[model samples]
Target: MYENKISARQLRRMIFIETFGAGALSIPAFACYKEQNGFWSLIFYGVFLAGTIAFFIIFSGKISEENFENRKIGKTGLARNVNINVSKMQTRLKSINFPEVLPQPIKFVYMIRFFINAVALFYFFGKTIQTVYMPESSFLFIIFPAAILLCYSLYTTLQKRARFLEIIFPWIITTYFIAVILSFIGIEKAMQIGNAGELWQGILSDNIFRSMGNGYLMLLCSSPIEFLLFLRPAAEERGTETKNRKVEDKNNKEGKNNREGKDDKAIRDIITAVAGAILCNVLFCFLSVRTLGPTLTSQSEWPVIKMMQLIRMPGGFLERFDILPIIFWILCMMAVLSGYLYYGWSIFQTRSGGCLKNFLGITFVCLVLLTCVVEKHTLLWTFYLKYKAFVDFPLSLILPLVVWLFKRQKDFNYQEKT
Candidate 1:
């Protein structure tokens, strides 16, 4: 019943906010631990992340969003929802004559991927808030508001979400850059350009896995773009039913023009994702060591807050600039939390379609809360790193390649048939 579309610029803003925010604070330490030179860590993160995003952009463009639109999409903004009836088929399903009742693996895998990304992020945000920001508050108290905001975001149209991000993107940049600039006061002038760290070949051999873990944090920070948002049928899509309309437009449009139009969009999509990832990440890592020396940067737990705290604005304007880091954390965490909730709820709908969606949604939220409350946050962090090392790397790389290749094969077969 709802219809929404956003410009490519709006989509780019959303990606920027998500990819750059939360990781900017704590991840430098993780990267520093892995690389002896410290510089290679920054370079590795950029190349590793840029490649993953580039693959996603090219693949998302290759498959038209309209293909998803041509079918009935769930409320979650994704394409696939396997609605299986197991009642009558309970007996037949046991007999292996249950193809119809079988769960779809692709949908299941994507669903799992989105949930893992979301939950890991959700836990991180909650932990940050619980520890540094609000030590007195209970875990549930810190997480509750975020959960509500996330639910609200999921209910709104994607265009609205993008629009909200556009408004905040500037302040996010201003606050972050100001902190980076002020950070110069804390470290030596000459060391601002280069960090003090020993160089070694351990980067390629020993510290590679930890780098993968940190790189995964960066990659999943903003989360991958949801292709169905574009591919699904827009309200204007059905207008093509008018034959006279198609003929009139066909007469006016040349093949070259159509190809150029698509190329323009494809280029914008790639350039935006790549540039945003690199720029945000590079500035973040550079500022980390430039603002705080390598030893301190690696030692500090909440580097963003620590880095921002050291910068005292001239004229004694405010007692402390530490609040800037908090603002940054809140902004980024809200966006990330909402994205996770949306993906999680969407997967629930895909699995159980009806009132069960409501039940499962509530259950999912509660389970996440319970896990965060009972589980030690440090242990959870370790599990997240291990998951990234084992699952996320292959999943992020292989999924897009498989999808892109599959699309190519389908196109080749269609051309042969025609």
Candidate 2:
């Protein structure tokens, strides 16, 4: 696990890419749901997500400290048992098996959820390429190469993936921001046509509860914070560990301080990544409605791409400036697809080779075939939109709260014993 560890910086970049790519795709839907008020909905969700993440991180640190102190004091009571059970549950969730604490049926359902998500990602990736770049090409022609590339990527090390993201992070951000800025040209054109004020026609929804309900669904589908459950454990805090024995005693206090600082940095990194992605989504949502006039934006399958096509490069330096953003967006989509497949692969214990790997590989092939056999992409989207709520709500929000409550009870019991 130490050898496979990624830094907080790498984790931040990974989160940003995953969240931004996935959220951008769903922005048009959210826009349709709330009209121009979607940006406000995104802001509210971002703030709520930030506060939730901060609380989780702080409480997780406290739990870790308490576990450590209990270990040092040789107290193998309720606290230690509870901690061990939680650790086992995390391990099982990430690696293999379903912990006894969760019902057996949940394991089967979770496996189905992972498969559905992976297939949906692959389908969307191929569909986007076919729609935008190769309208004439067969979907098979587009997806086959992508599947091969994704398989190759899965065989590579996590460190390499993280490093790749770190290197490309700046370029992705720049390309996306440039696209957003260029989109303002469309807004300017709309203003010249005397429809600029229409952009704010429904900036605040009259039915706030309806807006919130739709936004919550959008947040569940878009936000990648659930990845942190797997990613955070793999993120190594810088300066928290050292190889030099001579300085161990001297740097004990320094190491403690560094740990605290690094934890704060980790929390900041997460908040920044999530908030940045949300803001980017909001910007694109705003630009899409402003340029496409809300009605068309709501109707279009890919409103962001449509908005990009409407953008003309200044001075005609390039006839198709939209090509640049489309290319960058393709890269972002590939990253997102890879992330989904990689995490799904991890859950099947692919690292431990032999029969298990073979079995999982076969299962993956079946998923790809299933993706291909599914003729109606719209139905797939409908299924995902309708069902993901059940999966995301319980897993993302309720699960964490339940764990926190259980830990608090264990801590209370431990204190009573002491």
**Local distance difference test scores for all models:** 0.57, 0.62
Q: Write the per-residue lDDT of candidate 2 for residues 228-295, one digit (tens) a residue.
A: 65566556643333432234334245646645676677778877887888778777776766567656
Task: Give a tens-digit lDDT track for model 1, residues 69-182.
Answer: 112222432332356333212110011111112145644776666666666777777777777768898777777666666666656665567678779888887887776665
Q: Candidate 2, which segments miss by more than 4 Å at Cα?
A: 34-39, 55-111, 191-201, 237-239, 243-256, 313-316, 350-355, 376-378, 401-418
Q: Which ten residues in a row have the lowest lDDT in candidate 1?
A: 90-99
**Sequence-dependent TM-score of model 1:** 0.73
lDDT of 1 at 271: 60
lDDT of 2: 0.62
